[model samples]
Target: MRNFDQWLSEMRPSINEYNFYVNFEKVYANVDSMKVELNILNSLVGSKDIEQDFREILKRYPETLRCIPTLLAVRQHEIYAQDEEGAFLYDFSRMNYSVEQYIAFMKKTGLLSLIGEHIINNLVDYCLGIETGLDSNARKNRGGHQMERLVEVYLKKAGLEYYKEMYLTQIEQTWGVDLSAISAEGTSTKRWDFVVKTDQRIYLIETNFYSSGGSKLNETSRSYKMIAEEAKSIPDTEFVWITDGGGWKSARRNLHETFDVLEHLYNIADLERGIFNSIFV
Candidate 1:
């Protein structure tokens, strides 16, 4: 049996400087039960005529099961010897691998074609050298940037132009106002996510999409508070916060108290129907 620790030591220098990788190797090496299981898998796969049932094999060789999917995915690209069908088996192998593991495997295999189509297509095109797709990691650094891009496209297709127009057009037609006037000086500190100005008063608008709950929410909240404090400096200016992300279900109440006016999509529709009257009135 290959000493797992020795194998990991040989590969350690090539791995990224992340502690997680080190911890993963340590955990795998120290687990004696897992090591025994791996020996059984090695013996099973070594057989030639023994008809192997994957589930049955998995029962005895559970430790090796984790690597099977990755091996299958690599087979798709024929990184190993070509399968009987001559089709790449890598995809089949990767059925159970995590996204990161799949990506790492692709990188190791130098299968640019498969990587470009499967992983890069979903990540930010910039990171993967693609020209057209949105950066899946751009919005507040969440990993699901591709999913968010899809959502944005869907919202646009659904005739939700008001949301887009709010950012593009500084003027709020219903309220007979333009938010751009609130921070007319346009200092670094005055930059806000959204802003509107009416004949009666100026308003600063801060917008956020909270897909996941963590540092992103805290960072966004901090940004909003900064914008709010900046808006407050202007005597008559009001601060309005507009945020709608799936994570709002968990964070709505906490956020409401932090901002002067907090509105979700439901409130956005109502506010649009009533125009500025719902807010100002």
Candidate 2:
């Protein structure tokens, strides 16, 4: 048996690759799709009689209005706003409001001054910056995928035949193994992150990495503890949870509770130590 403090001491601060910070490829693609519209809107920059110019431009080229939301760093085509006078819904996908009302939106939202004062020289550059900011919000999802990818590396090195994201029903049908012990007689639907099939046993695996502390860590530990217990009822089946990160430190008590009963629980350090070679066979 592994010592709990030794296992906890092996938790990593992060598993982020350089690309995990921001998906520049996605950011570039997003900005590229709006290049033409953003360029057309560029005509609004530094106009002395900006409102009149904006009205004339919209009358001639209504399609340029579709890019308005991006200027405000919003992904939605429709945006709602309200003031003391009334509430209005603005649609950037098409011209749902009159030109005067759009101008009112620009004036009220300070977008009019933003463009008319030449705060930004180029709309394309400004939109690229906005896209980058928006891309940062997706890092959490990217981080999770990064952990899965990292584990896949070890799985490949170990020469194991594993499938990604196998549902309980699929696992039962594929291997002719009865998983009703864990699936609650087909009433519960749970998906294992990675399912490894060896000559002797089937390993249902879940992987996660958290850099910061949260209640989610505690809940995950508790839930996986129950999963560990449930796996015992199914013959020749094992439950494996591979988790790491400094975030677990905050929830170490709950994690330790799970760790006390979970024999197959491992971390990145265990992977480096060739834990797969010992158990996978």
Candidate 3:
């Protein structure tokens, strides 16, 4: 058995890959989808008569209205507000309110000033920048995927055929593992990150990476520990957890508890040492 200190020492400080920060491909796709709408709204830029110009543009291109909230960095089409004047829900989807009401909304919300005063030159370019800013919000999800992608690389390198996001039903039908202990009488919607078949055995894998400490790490540690025990009950099947990141340092006690019972748990450092070769062999 590995000592707690020794196991903690093996935890990685970071598993951040190059694409961990911003998924530019997804950002580009988002921006591309809104390109036509943003271009149509460009008519409002630097318009001395923003109200008249905006109404004219909307008459020709109703879809442009849906792109308005995003100019202010909002993801939704409907904006709600209660001001000194009155309460209103501005639906930019197709201008649910009158043009005058929208003009009032624009002026009150400072969007008219933003465009009429030439604060920005082109809505197309400006929205591209806004879309970039909005894409930053996806960093958390992208960061979470780094560990999965990293594990996939090693899995591929080990030459093991695998399926991603394998469900309990699929595993039962394929291997006949009797997952009743893990699922609710074999009717649960449980799924695993990856499932591999090799040399008369099936491996169930779970993966996660954390860069910051949170209560989630503790919960994840406990939960995966339960999964590890459940997998142990089925013959010819094993559970493998691939987790890393300095965040575990703060939750070492919880991680240590899981580590004590789950020897198949590994980190980035373990992969670097060719652990997959031994395990997958």
> Where is the poorest 10-residue window by lDDT in model 3?
15-24
Decide which is better by lDDT, 1 or 2.
2
Summarize candidate 1's per-residue lDDT along 1-281 as a digit string, tens digits.
33323322221111122332233333333333334443444443323322333344544444444443332331122244343434333343224444444344444554333333332232222212221112222323433333333334434444332232243133344454434443444333334444444456655544444554665666666656555655555555576665444554454444544443323222233233443444431
For each candidate, what is the lDDT? 0.39, 0.91, 0.84
Model 3 gets an lDDT of: 0.84
- TM-score, predicted candidate 2 vs. hidden true structure: 0.94
Which sections of candidate 1 miss by over 4 Å?
Answer: 1-190, 222-230, 259-277
**Residue 203: error of model 3 in Å?**
1.1
TM-score of predicted structure 3: 0.88
Better of 1 and 2 by TM-score: 2
